[model samples]
Target: MAKRKWLRGLALLLLVALLVVGGMYLYGSSSGTVPPATVDFAKLSPEQEKTLYARGEQVFRAGDCAACHSSPQTGAELAGGVPMVTPMGTLYGTNISPSKQHGIGNWTADDLYRAIASGVAPSRKLLYPAMPYTSYHQVTRGDVDALWVWLMKQPAVEVANRANAMQFPFDVRPAVALWNAVERPAAKPFDASTDALSRGKYLVDVMGHCAECHSPRTLTFALDKSRYLEGSIIEGAYAPAITPAALSGRGWTRDDLVRFFRTGLSPQGVMTFRMASVLDHSTSHMPEEDLRAMAAYLTQDQAMPGPKPKAPQGEVNVKGEAIYVGLCAGCHGVQGQGQPQSSVPLNTNTTAMFPTPINLIRVTREGLQERDLPHGGRMQSMPGFADKLSDQDMADLVNYLRQTWGGQPGDVTPAQVADLVKTIEHGDQ
Candidate 1:
């Protein structure tokens, strides 16, 4: 009996040691998160050359590469180091510069294509989803090929890739591989239909990558297919739905979209600094025809889906409402009218009116940077409350806001709150 007990204790120690070693190995493996390997660009003929460069320019616009890669604030064009915050962690956009050591100078065209389309490094390690490989998977082979050619010709710089500040469990690269294996496919093709709108759909679905921001995601970081283009909370800002129902209230016209895409401003109002920043660097450069097609495609009824069914509410929800009144009503107002000129109205605002629970949770936690409001003269900004409020408080506030003013009634689960909290806490948003 004594010998058996001793053996069991030794086995337990071994198990614990194995777990620790496994964890470190997984962590160290992530250090090989380099871009894909280089391709033999000299293999392409002259005719293939012009086409590749042309296609590269198009993909560049659609993917919004310049938006994050170029440091406009620092006047460092394409010497990347932009910070992208998400609900999971803060990702610093790295130098795609051709410098051999600091950037992807050693990468070939094939390496660029693989990274653009699949989000895998040349070393085959899975990239964090924050890089938007899930949406980029839709990019066509031709487009990927073109993008690679274009990126290869760009001037090289020696800026090092920044270390990602993601939290544990999520910081593990093997876990990211698991996520990609389970939630995403190895590849996705553009939808083929004869309609012009369908071609537009192909661009947005694949190359344009609109779904990266527009599509809502589940707690596991998988796209919520049922709610595609239904909008999601990104960083502290809510990427509002492009649906007719969502846009209908905003009174957006096709012309309005055109103007917004052209200059990041329209008669209806501005798209805000974050969106403006996106458009200034990317969308504005897109061909007018493609922009028009994108606008038409987004405005279509077929693109946007309906909201999900509400769950049965229990007595706990009733308790949550009481909590909202005691906490939120002071600033948001009792009638949800908001503090006029000081707070945004929760009843009719585009974000508040949306049925999804994401916006509410996001707003309560991160709060809005009022200065970034698009139509500053017309709208007031609310501060982020992440530090002041608990995850439950945020859920209750969101629940109350959604049920009472958002035109949806569903119980906010603690699990959802916890997941979002983790994302935000980890530096995602």
Candidate 2:
């Protein structure tokens, strides 16, 4: 009698568990109420089509869609082969061109809205959060409509999507429903009518989605709202804090912010890392007025101190100074005043001021590529020194930079550099 009762209890527990999981899957995989299409597709006149196409192009630039969706090899704007490396695994951007076989040519505006706003694709396919639908949850429906018209008009590229390399349970696409139920924010429309500040917030938070990288992630890899824009380490380098206070402390001014966004060059530094793609695809092409609004919103109209050299924090390392003079002083002046339009000055650069020395170390070892920036700004090639410097030498050089100009303690060690190298190599792979 006892054994029979125990078996019955076990069966009842299993049933209850199954019911709970089923409810979660149903709720999580379901799409939210999609907003009505802003324009009637069949009734559009030529003038309306033109207006929407222009607006859609603007929306695409602001959203930086090409940064991830463009082909690295062919430079096709929507062919979609860029690889995004994350802790869970690598995910390639999907083909978003107009090919009916491989792209969204047949998708209705409502389908795009569902994907962008609610993270649900057709046939109840759940997109991984790498798509940034969380930040796009509040995007306006009108913008999506305009984007759809423009996207469909572009020449179709017949490229199929690359398969994802997610590991273990994450490979099970349906399991993403649980993550959605727990962490996904509800889709809502943005209210940009309040003021310029509101418009700026819309551009930065909703359209630009800056916080997706700048903000720290929770253990579940969701953006931690508690530390919004406070900086985070991603893709093996630090995405520095961009809060108003952090910006002001780093000697950033509103004017400089606009200049950087428009030209990819400023006294602060040249754009590097993932931001290089951003400058090429998005900010350089943005309207001046929109750039100003983004800058003003970031600075909150606060009086900025601008760029100033930091005082030396400690005794300089002799070996580090020798390395700088031998290889660096020719381009960057001995006093750290960089050549105009070529090298960036070290004294005012913010890389060393960051809490971690990973960026400094990474850039030093790998160097930067020569490129022409927008608005006639250009930088010469910086050759990588990976084979030239030892781990100890790197630590000493970084320590010297931090102490002399970053106002940071010379505390970096060889062991730390070795560990950070592993991270850098993994990101490169």
Residue pairs clashing in model 2 are none
Writing each residue's lDDT as its tens digit, candidate 1 over 304-400 gives 3222222323333565567667766787666656665456555544454555456566556665555432223334455667786676766766666
Top lDDT hit: 2
Report lDDT (CA) for all predictions.
0.64, 0.88
Top TM-score prediction, candidate number? 2
lDDT (tens digit, per residue) of candidate 2 on 1-429 = 999999998997776566556634665445788989889999999999999999999999888889989998898989998999987788998888998988888898999989998788887788888999899999999999999999999999999889999875466676667777788888998977857677889899999999999999998999999999999888888899999999998899999999999988888899999898899999999998899989989998899999998899979988888988887889878888889977999888888788899999999999999988998889888877889999999998999888888889999999999999998878732
- Per-model TM against the reference: 0.65, 0.94
Question: Lowest-lDDT window of 10 residues in candidate 1?
Answer: 304-313
Clashes of 2: 0
